[model samples]
Target: FFWGFLAGFLEIVPYVGTTIGGILPVFYMLMVSDTLWQPLAVIGLYILVQQIEGNIISPNIMGPSIKINPMFIILGLFVGGIVWGISGMILALPILAVSKEIFRSFDATEPLSYLMENGLARKKDVFLERFDHEKHRILRLFFEKREEGE
Candidate 1:
């Protein structure tokens, strides 16, 4: 009962929430159970549930609905937690979705929207290309100086 409640409550935080929720109950079982099989069974059950939820449910259902990359979500989670603790983590996804839309709506900020989006169909990295060009130039200059004994 308590484990269910913990799992449900922590589900709001995304990613690691379900994991922590499942782990605590397993820890409690380990401490109290005389037989090791019970705790092992609990661990197995949690793994199965996590796999189903993460691989099957999330990719098919939540993926299209959210549309944001997992990387951005993870980044937002960190930033939110750092800024406002648990409440921030709970609010991060909605805030990020809204911000992505806001960025999408304006021509000036559309690039940010692209950045936040899942990159499954994206063909090129605009920022990375520019960064790579500068990097090559810097490396060329450095090598030239080394060759000239400077």
Candidate 2:
């Protein structure tokens, strides 16, 4: 009952909650059980459940509603946790959603909004394209300088 309740409560947290919820029971099993197989079984079950939740369930359910890239969600969680601990993690998604909207509202920041979005249909390699353009410009200047010297 206690493990179930704990796991349910932690499920409110994004990304790492299910993991921490599973760890507690596994630790308890490790200490109390006489046989090693029991604890190992607990670990395997938790791993399977977590994999299902993370990959299949989450992407299907939360992916559309949240509309942020999985990469950005993970990054937000890390930054939020680092800056404000547990509270930060809890608030991260809403904050990101709001910020993405704010970015979308302005024409100048629309590109940032696109980067944060889950959509991949119109994905732009902004950084690489800019870097490649710069590289060609620099090489042209370098050759121009060499020709002038000759």
- Of the candidates shown, which would achieve the greatest TM-score relative to the real structure? 2
Per-residue accuracy of model 2 over 36-121 as CA lDDT, tens digit each = 99989988887887789779997899778879987899999999999999989989899999999998786456556767887545
Q: Provide the overall lDDT of each model, using Cα atoms, as 2-decimal numbers.
A: 0.81, 0.79
Question: What lDDT does candidate 2 reach at residue 123?
Answer: 52
| 45 Cα displacement, candidate 2 (Å) | 0.5
Q: Where is model 2 more than 4 Å wrong at Cα? A: 13-20, 69-93, 107-112, 120-150
- Per-residue error for 67 in candidate 2, Å, reads 1.9
User: Can you list the residue pairs that collide in candidate 1?
Assistant: none
